[model samples]
Target: MSRRPPARRRPARRPRRPRQQQEHLVGLLLAAAAALWLMATVVHWLLAHWWILLAAAVIAVLGGIGWWQQRVQRAQWEHAQARALRYGLPQLDALSHRQFEYTVRDLMYRDGCTDAVQVGGQGDLGADVKATDPHGRRWVIQCKHRRHGEQGAAVGTPELQVLNGTGRPVHKADVVVMVTNGRITQPGRDFARQQRLHLVDRQLLASWAAGSRPLWELLPALPPPRKPSRLS
Candidate 1:
C-alpha cells in the first residue's frame, strides 16, 4: 500500500538567479556606500566649524604624507641594516657603514666636496656613491672595505671598467674615486695613474683608521705627506 500510495512529490526548485541581478546588486551597494559616505561627510561638516573641517583635511593630508615617508625611511634603514649585518656589521653596522662612508666623503669634504649621496643607486647603471664638490665637480665614489683582508680597499680595473663604461652614459660625471682600505694592485694603480685617476692610498687611509688624522683634521689645505704611526 505504501509503495503504491503515491510518488512523493518533490519540492519545486527555486529559479536560478540571473547574472544581471548580481551586477545590479553591486551597483546598488556602491551607490548606497557613496550616499552614506556623503551623508557622513556632510554631517561632519555641519557639526564642525568651517575652520575645523579645513584643519581636519590638512591634518589628514599631512598624516598621510608623514606615514609614507616613515615607511620609506624604515624600509631603507632595514635594507641597509640587513646588508650591514650580512657583512658582519651587527645592529651597530649602520654606524660602521656610516663611519666608513663618512671617511670616503671626508676626502670630498676636505677638498670641498658637496651634495654627496651616501649610497647611490641599486638598479641598472648604479654607482656606489655620487657626489658634487663645491666647485660643481661631480665625483663617483666607490667604497670597498672588508672585515677580512680579502675585501680590502683598492679598486681594480674591473670596477673602474664598470664606472668608465657607466660614466660615459651619465652627462654629469667628472671624476671617479675608487676608494678602498687595501692597496690597489700595481696594474690597477698603473691604470689609474695612466688614466689620470686620483689615488687615495692606504698609508693615508691608515691615518684615518688610527684616528690620528680624523677626516675633520684634513682640509683642502693639508700639508704634504708626513710620517705617521703604522697600521697593523
Candidate 2:
C-alpha cells in the first residue's frame, strides 16, 4: 500500500470575545477624552449611537417589570387557590372579576407560556389575556367567570364570534381561547368547532386548577381526526 501524504495542518482560530465585553470595550474607546474618566459617558455614547443597545435596555426594563408583576400575581393566585381548595375547586366562583382574570393569567404562565399578560376590562375588545408560547404563537383568551349555579348561564356563539373577530389581525393571535366557569351552549360549541376556537369549560378549568391535568394534555390546537376513507 502507498504511504498516505501528511495531512495539512489547520490554522488556529482566535478566541472570540463575548458580545457584551466587545460592546463595552468599543463604547469605552469611543468616549471623548474629557469624559473618558466617567463610565456613565461611555454608556451614554453607546445608547446614543447604538439604537439596538437602547432598545435592549428598554426591553430589559420591561421584562423586569413583567417578571415582578408575574411574581406578585402568582402569589395572589396561590393565595386564592388555597382558599378555593378549602371548599373545593367550586369555591373559584367566589373570586372577583379582576381576581378571576389574574387567576387565568397565572394558569397560562404555568402552562408553559413564555409570557401571559392581562388586558381585560373596558375596551379589551373581548380578549382578557394575551399569551405567547415558546414557539412564538400568540393566543388571546377570554375568561367568563360565570357562577356555577342552577340559573345555568351558558356562554354562547355571540361571545365566540366577538373573540374570533378581534383575536386575529387586531391582537395578532394565532389562536383564541374562551374559558368559562359555566356550560357552553350547543350553538357555541358548533360555532367554535367551525371556527377552530378553543373552548375550555367548567370541568376542564377545575381539573387544570386542581393540578390534575397539565395544559399540554388539554391543548386545543390539535387537529380534528380525519374521517375514514370510504374506499377502505
Candidate 3:
C-alpha cells in the first residue's frame, strides 16, 4: 500500500509561437525593405532635380540668416527698452542730497568702479563718493544737485578749486570727478581742464543713464601721449 502512493503530476509547459516569431521577422524585413526603397526613390528624385535641391538649400540658408537677424534686432530692441526704463535722469533732481550722492555711487559701481561708496556728510572732506576704477585708479567724486529754479549761480570755478584741494591732498585720489545734475560754469570747465579733473554734467549723466554712452567714453581727453583711463 505505501509503494502505491499516487505519483505527482508536473505542470504543462506553454508552447512557443514559432509562426508568430517568423511572422515578426518577416514584418521587420518588409519594413526595412520599404524604408530602403523609399530612400532610393528620394535619392533618385533629388539627383534628377539637383537644381531644385540647390534652390532649396539656398532658400534654407537665407531663411536662417533672416531668422538670426530678426533675433538680433529683437534683442537690441529689448535692451533699449530695458535701458530706457532702468534710470530716469530727470528724476534725480527730486531726490535729497544724500539720495543723489547714493545714486552717484550706484552709477560709479555700474561703470566698473569697485568699492563705490557714498561718504557724503557734513565733514566728508569734499568727497561725496569714493571708488577705484578697473585700472586701480582711485577716484574721489563730488555730487552737486540743483533744482530747476534755484537762485544760486551754477557750480563755478571756486567749486573746482575746493574739490582739487581735497581730491589729491586730503583723499589721495588719482582721479577727481565732479558730477552735477545742473550746469558747470565755463570757468569751472576751464579750471577742471587745467587740473585734469573729470566733470560729468547734466547731459552727459543723462546719456550715461540712457545707455547711449559709457562714463569712460565721456571723460575729457588728456594731454598728448597720455592714454585714456579705462574702466576696470
Candidate 4:
C-alpha cells in the first residue's frame, strides 16, 4: 500500500494593517516629496537659471514615483473593492423575480441567444429561461433575485434538475445558467460547481450592466416573450 502525503496547508490570511500605518506611509512620502521640493527651491534661489531645470527634473521624478506607487497598489485596491462588494451586496440592485428572468434573457441575447423564455409555472423543476442560438443550440437559465433582509436562502440544485428536464430528460438540456443579484450561500455555489451549473452572481451582472463584459448585442429593456398570448 502506498502512503499518502499530508495535505498542504493553505496560507493564513494576513490581518488587516492599521489605518495609522497607511497614514504614516503617506506622511513619509509627503515628507520626501517636500524635501525634494525644498531642495529644488534652494537650487532655484542659488542657481537661478538652473533652478527651473532642477525643479522640472524633480517634478518629473515625483510624477514617475507617484505613477509607480499607484501601479504597485492597483491589485490591493482591486481586492479591497471585492471585499467592499461582499460587505455591501444588498446595496446592489435586485430586480423583481419576473424582471430578473427577463434581464437574464436579455443578457443572453446580448451573448447571441436570439430565442429565450421563462419556463411556465413549474415551481422548481423547469428551466426559467430557455434560449436558442443561430446554430440551433439550446440553453436554459434560472434567475434568482435575492432581496435584502428577505430570506435564509435562494436558488438551489433543483434548478439543475429543472434544467435537466424535471427528472425525465436526464441531462438533455445543452446549457444551464443561473443568475442572482446577491451572493449565494456557500452550499448553493458548491451545488452549482458539483453539478456543472453556471452561477452569475451580483458582481457578474453589475459588470455586464456596466459594459465591462463584451457581448454581441444588448437590449437595455427585457422584451416581452415573442409567443402570442390570449390576454394580450
- Considering every candidate listed, which one attains the maximal lDDT? 3
TM-score of each: 0.43, 0.57, 0.57, 0.44
lDDT of 3 by residue, 1-232 (tens): 3677799899997777987899999999999999999999999999999999999999999999999999999977755554444356658777788888998877777666658899999998889999877666688999888866133348889889989989999999877899887888998999998889989888877877657454666786622222355322
Candidate 1 matches the true fold with a TM-score of 0.43
| Tens digits of per-residue lDDT for model 1, 87-140 | 122211233444666656544443334465566436535366676654445666
The per-prediction tally of clashing pairs is 4, 0, 1, 2
Model 2 spans with C-alpha error above 4 angstroms: 1-88, 149-151, 223-232
Q: Report the error of model 4 at residue 220, Å.
A: 25
| Candidate 1 Cα outliers beyond 4 Å, as residue runs | 1-99, 106-111, 124-126, 149-154, 207-232
* Model 1 pairs in collision: 108-113, 153-180, 153-181, 153-182
lDDT of 4 by residue, 1-232 (tens): 9999999999997766777799899999999999999999987786867868889999999999999999879956754543332223443354567766766665555554546566635564656677765444456666667665235355565554455444225424555666667666677677766666666666666666555332212212222434453322
- Model 4, stretches more than 4 Å misplaced? 1-94, 120-124, 134-136, 149-171, 212-232
TM-score between model 2 and native: 0.57
lDDT of 4 at 27: 100
Give lDDT per model, in order.
Answer: 0.57, 0.76, 0.80, 0.59
Q: In angstroms, give how far residue 73 of model 4 lies from its true place.
A: 49
Of the two candidates 1 and 3, the one with more favorable TM-score, higher being better, is: 3
